[model samples]
Target: MSDAERQRRIAEAAYHKARERGFQGDRHLDDWLEAERELDRQEPRRP
Candidate 1:
């Protein structure tokens, strides 16, 4: 998958996991999601 797609899936998974654990604030979820995306963006992809 492309970087954007990979990041999106990772963020979505994390968001759902947090929600399942009772994370209710939009700000917290958004911040976590953005952090995941940023981390993925910084990583080098393997061929």
Candidate 2:
């Protein structure tokens, strides 16, 4: 997928993660990074 699409997916994943935790403390960055790692593992970038 394109960079924009990838970013959108990550953002959506992060949002869901945050929502899952009741949108508690300031963990946006952690959620985003976790999303990125999950996505990357699912589909690694091309060389």
Candidate 3:
């Protein structure tokens, strides 16, 4: 996928995670990083 699409997925994941956690303070950055990492883990490698 394109960079924008990747970003959108990550943002959506982070938003959901934050909501699940009750939208507490200062977790958005954590949410984004965790979401991105989770996505990376699920993606297949070509090399």
Candidate 4:
């Protein structure tokens, strides 16, 4: 799968996991998701 698609799945899983654990604050999730994307971008791609 493409990087973007992988990121989307990761974000979705994070969201559901947070919800299951009773996490509050929309900003918290957003910040985590944004950080994940940034990290992904910074990582070197495999051949």
Instruction: Write down the lDDT of every candidate, Cα atoms only.
Output: 0.69, 0.98, 0.89, 0.67
Per-residue lDDT of candidate 3, residues 17-37 (tens digit): 999989989989999999999
Clashes of each: 0, 0, 0, 0
- The residue-level lDDT of candidate 3 at 26 comes to 91
Give Cα distance to truth, residue 16, candidate 3, Å: 0.4
Cα distance off (Å), candidate 3, residue 17: 0.5
lDDT of 4 at 16: 67
Please provide, for model 2 over 1-47, each residue's C-alpha lDDT reduced to its tens digit, 9 standing for 90 to 100. 89999999999999999999999999999999999999999999876
TM-score of 2: 0.96
Tell me the deviation in Å of residue 13 in model 4: 0.2
- Give the Å error, residue 28, model 3: 0.7
Candidate achieving the largest lDDT: 2
Candidate 3: minimum summed lDDT over ten consecutive residues — where? 38-47
Candidate 4 residue 17 Cα shift, in angstroms, is 0.4
Q: Rank the candidates by lDDT, best first.
A: 2, 3, 1, 4
- Candidate 3, position 45, lDDT: 33
Strongest candidate by TM-score: 2
lDDT tens string, model 4, 1-47? 57887677667767765776588666666756765766568664566
User: Where is model 4 more than 4 Å wrong at Cα?
Assistant: 24-47
Model 4, residue 16: C-alpha shift (Å): 0.4
